[model samples]
Target: MAALSAAEQTVDTEHFSESMHSLSSDAEAFPADSAEQHDFVVDFIEKEVGSDLKSLKNVSNLLKKLTDENNVLEEQVLTVSSSVPPKVSAALSAAEEARCSLEELLKKERLISNMLHQHLQGAQPWMDNLGQILNQVDHIERHMEYLRCLQHIEELSAAVQQCLMTSSVWEAIRAVDSMAALDTGLSQSACSHLQDFLRETLHFWHKIIKDRLTIDFEKVLTQLHWPIISPPTQSLTPTASSPEISSQLELLVTQLLALQTSDDLLSQKDLASGKGGPSAQTVSLATPTSLAPPLCLPIQIMLLPLSKRFRYHFFGNRQTNTPNKPEWYLTQALMWMGNSTTFMEEKIQPILDRAGADISARVELCRGLLSLVQEKVASDASRLLYDDALFSHLVEEVLQFEKELRSNHSYPAALPGLLHLLLEDAVLQKWLTVERKMAVEKMDAMLSAEGAWSSQYKDISDMDELKAPDCAETFMTLLQVITERYRALPCPSAQLKFLGLQRELVDDFRIRLTQVMKEESRCPLGARYCAILNAVNYISTILSDWGDNVFFLQLQQAAVSLGDDVVLRDLGVLELGRLASLEGSLFEGLLALLDRLKGDMLGRLLEWTMREVIEKARPYGQDRWLSLPSQHDLSTMTLSSSACPMMLCVRDRLLHLHQSLSLSLFQLAWQGLADRLNKFLYQDVRRENPQKHCLCFYDLSPTSLNV
Candidate 1:
């Protein structure tokens, strides 16, 4: 048994050695490149030997253990070998397939993108070409339409020219020498055709030019430069065909001149006459004998030779050649001269002559002449009847006429007429009041020069420099004149003594007050003016009455009228001062007035007056003289200066008023103070001084509170 066991072991050992040798040979042939390969070999050997050595208790147990271990080893080896090779092969194939699919998709996307790009590129040119083609077609169609319209217009113009040139039409037009005497139906037809032709021509031209081409034909006609004809020589050869037309034109001119002089001829009457004098029975018609012969007489008179031989032959004898002789030649010459002179005299000289008759009439005439002059000036006409020299002459003539009217005392009854004339003339109306005043002043001067009344010129000139006088003297003079005229007339007029007395009283009061204001220097000029105004205001209060006292009422009304000048002057000063600082003198005058107004209704009135000033006055600019200086620029010297001290005094006064008065009064006082402060602050800031530093320091200190 031991030998058999030995023999089995030996056989196993030998078998193991042979297997190991084969494996070793295979390993050598392959040349194992890793430690894993060496580890696998060692592990196989330990598994085969370890199981056999650990199981000595039963041979069957050993065998069973060994067999189970061998089976597990065999299965692990098979599983590793088979599963690894397939998995590796499958993985490699999958990776390659995925890469190829991805590449194919990328190529397809690229192709699609390229196709879209090419498509857009191809469409762009087609859209541009289509747009260009449409534009060309539209332009061509528009031009074609314009050309067609132009063709129609040319045809219409030609037709119109043909109609105008017709022989029958020319004869018919010539037969009626005057435009008014032409057949109504024929004229209407002609006018209609002409208008239609013009319309068509204008439309065609507009279409051709592709713009507006319409012109004002009437304006063009008025501006036409007609050629002047020279005198024809007796030896000149006449064209046979032109004679009839020339004769017809000459006849037409003769008739037109005659018709122009006939003012009574209406359109219907002229049209019905048909070139012959109106029927003998017509009520409105002038007698054929009464109407002057046609202008052909003048043409004939012009044709006569001026030689002494011809004159002698035409006059026949010495008795007929006398200056006053009534020979046919003399009569014709006189008639021609008279006609020419009449036309000129009526058109120009009479206008001025009529104007010179009275002040009002002269004013009206001057206005009309001015209007005519303006029209000519605006038109820029080549020939003006009234040149600068002529206009100056006319003005001098007007002045002379005014002088005459003043000497004659014609203005009282002519005021309304003068006003009407002035209103009608644009040039004269611009300074109507000034012109009227000048005229009145000139009259007054004349009266003074003539020594017709007391010399008020000195008083007037003195007052003119100081202020506008209340015009009370003039009003009074007018009232006195009217009352005297009314009283001196008759028994019925004697009752107007009451009216005269009242007028005299009112006038005396106004004149005396005005003189007092002018002559007296006791009070401020403003106070004196205010006093005059107060008197006028009192008169106005009486005048506004609608009650019965004819003469008394008029006297009061005159006083009221005198006040207008004062009010206007005051308002003007107020307006001017609103935009600037009030003059020191003016302010002093106002302060004087204010002092007088204390504790009275005048004080209350002042509140309203100042309110009006504040509301109506524009806010002054920052550059105004009253503006204050900035803190940085202010100096101690400035603070202690005369102007600053005055301002501070005024500010203190206003502060007192603000505290003592009602809210409204307080606000007004504060507003005045604020305006003053602002002026000082802003304006003083711009001035430079070394003392400014000290003043600034003083301002910063608590002691500045008192300042």
Candidate 2:
């Protein structure tokens, strides 16, 4: 609007200039032309001035209208311009605030982005750990499905207990079967607690069922008057209650057989699949003999009367309960077994046969009775071991009982009899210790006896036999008895243990001989010394012979089973490896003893013969012996009959040794004496120069010196 107003003003100014220029042109044209020009100009002005005046009037009106309009437009422009600054300032301030707010928002967005980045970095490991945990969970979920049966386990447990308590045999068995199946299935669970809970529940059920069966079976057995003490006669007949008792016994046996079969089948399945879990492994570890068989409980129940009787007669303070006669109780136990086992085999075995239970009632009966007997014997032996006589009787009776069980009754080897208890490592160790101690005591007593070292060569009935002193012969006999008693032991460890004990005894004997040798008077050629030498030789010969015995040889190759290395080492088996022959220990000890004897005999011979003989022979050596004696003179002039004191001493010593020692030992002693005497005569009796020596030079020939 302002530019339009300015354009209108410029057009009006241009028109006014054009009009003034026209008037000036007209004036110039009319210049200086007197009256005519003035007249012409006045005419022209009158005509044009009239039209211009009218036109100028119209223009003045138009200019006035334009001036008014321009004034109104300028006022309106001033009003708008005046208000626009404050409004623009308000707008600019508002824009500035919006910009600041945008900057703050950007800063906050950047900060949040950085925090998020840091969080992501820290959470990387967490994510990885979560992934691993999820994988483990997945794996557990795969195996945990097997334990799903646990939800009903408490219910099954209650059901089994209820059935057992109510004497619902079939229902109880079925419930037990369900629990067993659950146990077998859940054994593969990865949860240890679940497996433990399931197994505990299953085992409790088994125990409950077993107890119920035992109670019912005992009732049946009592009703039948089972395990009758006396022998059954050929004309014996059944009683009115026999059919009911037999039927009840059959049902009890059937239930037991079913449970046993379940255990067996579970074991076989685990083995067949080659998969063992805690339950399967536990079941597999149980053996019929190690633990009681299914029939063992009833068998024990049947033997209750017999056991009571035996305990009454033997275990109490009765006359028959004497410790001196363990065989009394042992015989009674055997008789009970003989009486009961036949009846069981004839009557109870048919029940098993009818039930298809593959177990021997006879064997189980004997095992039960023998178990009672073993328990009694072990109890008695524990106290009796402190008494030598009682202990010996106990051991003897136990052996006799074992022999009867194996030989007379044809006892099953699978079932451990009295010997197993007797041959336990601890028990066997006690027995070995007792034997060793007793042997040592006996050996000491015999060695200290008045005539213990006297040579029994002449006293023996057989002249051709080699003879030793009483102690040596007795020791050999004791050793033979010990060997015979333990030689038939089935356990290699027991056999090796006994063999090791024997070896220790041999070494101990050697030590005793050494002590005796040291205690004896310095008389190497005396009767006692000769007897010792003969004893050493005799024991050595016996040990050497026994070392090669088949029993010992087999023991050497036998591996030490259930034997303690420390105990075995104490027994001298450690010097030999586990499988090495233990006979070497005995042989080594005897050889050492023999060497000591030889050296002692030689040293004593030299000591005694050279004690005063050298000084006495000084006079003899001064005598001349330029001429040698004849052969007949030499033959008659044996040292035994020689009158020279040196010859007399040698003759007396050698004669004594010959009379006392066995022939072989005498030869050994003689050879040692000959060598020693030869050295002595050459070195001590004779002068350094042969020409200076005289008296017995020719008399010192081997034949003249021989006894």
Candidate 3:
């Protein structure tokens, strides 16, 4: 309006200026309450315009008269009237002054706007940030509302309690749920109030449902003396209508989950869990046989603590920070599973695993576990139900069960329920897959041509390192590391499966040994024996750890049998050679190896040696192989007694063996071997297949077999 008034002033004065006749319209458009000033301006304008108008009329009459008279007279009249109206000239001059002032104001305003634009450029970023801050602040009121509501938790708790007391369950549920909608930690005072509220809620609900369930539970303990698992509520399926679940147990769990409690209150629930009643009567169980063990408690008593644990872990106040959006019912449905697992492993499994545990007890325990599991994890037909806890429990049960069975040196009963439980859980499937992978890994580690350098893999040389973690390892050697690893492994049934895999590896190792022995070279035979000894000892040593696992016992027996077969099959050559290389001696029983060699490789080698002796003697022109002259020299035949050092070594070894053995075992074993060889030499080498010469053993053997 100022700019417009200023522009109007400038235009009125500098451009086609308006006459005073429009002043009345201008006054009305620009009204003011200054009556004195208005009257003054009106008087001044009337006085100024009055004379001008009188002069103009006189001039106009004079011009008309003059025009009628003469043109010169008209010009003179107009000049005289213009001079007579000086006040009107003063008013025109004031309007010109106002226009000039407005022009100055416009120039100053332009200058100020230009300066502000420069500063505004620098301030744009701050302005933009301020805008964003204002937008974010829009939620401040809502956050304050939530905080205010949080402060009122005590009041809300009171309201809920009142609602519950009045039997307005829906109102109580709404009140509690509204409290749940908030996600904030409470002050200690408020938290205590909340815990009080939660306790009241629990007390109220328990007041309604306790008597009914207590009676049922007490009757169950008194009569059946076992867990009376409620039939599972059908999980949410499209075709199936919801099962009517008014059972006191379900109601107790359901209502308890709807409130808020402190961590301490959550830990304190026993009466609601059915433990306040009298303890179940214990029956005297018949003592188990030597093979089977007995459990520590009867089934009802065993499940009692578990029942309490489940009630404690599950059926709690909906936590303050817990998510409130998910389908809470399905969560409540699956809630017992995790509690059941903790209860079974911590409370029940130990009893079943105790010494002298009876099968009947295990059966009852399994039944309880299965029933509890089915009731919680399997009962839900809801699509949203997740039973990961179920798989973890079943895995622990099967693994621990097998471990107990193996430890007691007893077998397990067929549990079709366990199989079905495992079969339904995809987690169990994945667990089995991981177990299989570990088994394969162990076997590959065993069979790999390369040795394990790190402690992670088995190294035959690092027996102590291998034995380090093998606390319960029964194996006397490096194999105990594997047993320990498998035992510590998390996969269900992995220890037994891994032991079976070791057995397969052992079979493969034996086959490899057989293939190696088929080679004709003797030099490679020594290295082969070393490899065999190392491999067999590596396994056999670990298999000695029967304290933890019974399966290692089987491997130990197999390893011993393999050792015996390899030693006797080689006729103590490999064994004696190995012991000799290591600067060790054979035991007294190794002399028996000589007997095992008869009619085998050692017999053929012996027959070939006698023929070589006969031929060497002929070349010596000593048709004298019958007996070495006590003074005979081997120089002529390039051998003493015409026998190779290997033969003489064998001969000397036999002599030593005979000297060491008493007459009985030595004759029963190697004496027969020597007699058969001598018979072959005398009958076949001397008469039939060799030159007729007296082949003599007097230099190396006893008189009876010297031939």
By lDDT, the best candidate is: 2
lDDT for each residue of candidate 3 in 508-550, tens digit (9 for 90 to 100): 4345433443452243213232233233333433333332243
List residue ranges in candidate 1 displaced over 4 A.
1-120, 165-513, 516-707
TM-score of 2: 0.56
**Poorest 10 consecutive residues by lDDT, candidate 2:** 279-288
Candidate 2: regions farther than 4 A off: 1-225, 231-301, 308-327, 345-356, 377-396, 419-437, 455-457, 461-464, 480-508, 553-587, 606-656, 676-707
lDDT of 2 by residue, 296-381 (tens): 44554566677688778877789998878888878887787777765787678898888766778888877666656766776776
The order of the candidates by lDDT, greatest first, is 2, 3, 1
**Models, CA RMSD each:** 30.5, 32.8, 33.3
The per-model lDDT (C-alpha) reads 0.38, 0.69, 0.42
Candidate 1 residue-wise lDDT, 1-707, digit = tens: 98997776676666666866876777777765435665687686666565574332244454578799999999999989988988999999999999999999999999999999999899999989999999999989967855654454455445434533563333322322222232222344434554344444433422222111112211221232111012222322334544553444344333323323221233333345453343222211221222222222112222222223334533345554432222333233323332333222332234334433212222333222222222222222112123433332333333333343334333333222111221223323232233234434543553234332222343554433212223433443544443443332222222233343343345444445545544533332233333343434334333333123454344334323443332124445564443133222212223333234322323443343334333322222112332346555755523333234444445555554433333333454456545544444334543433333433332233233222
Give the runs in model 3 whose Cα sits over 4 Å from its true position.
1-398, 401-437, 448-524, 530-623, 626-641, 644-647, 651-680, 683-693, 696-707
Q: Tell me the lDDT of candidate 3.
A: 0.42
lDDT of 1: 0.38
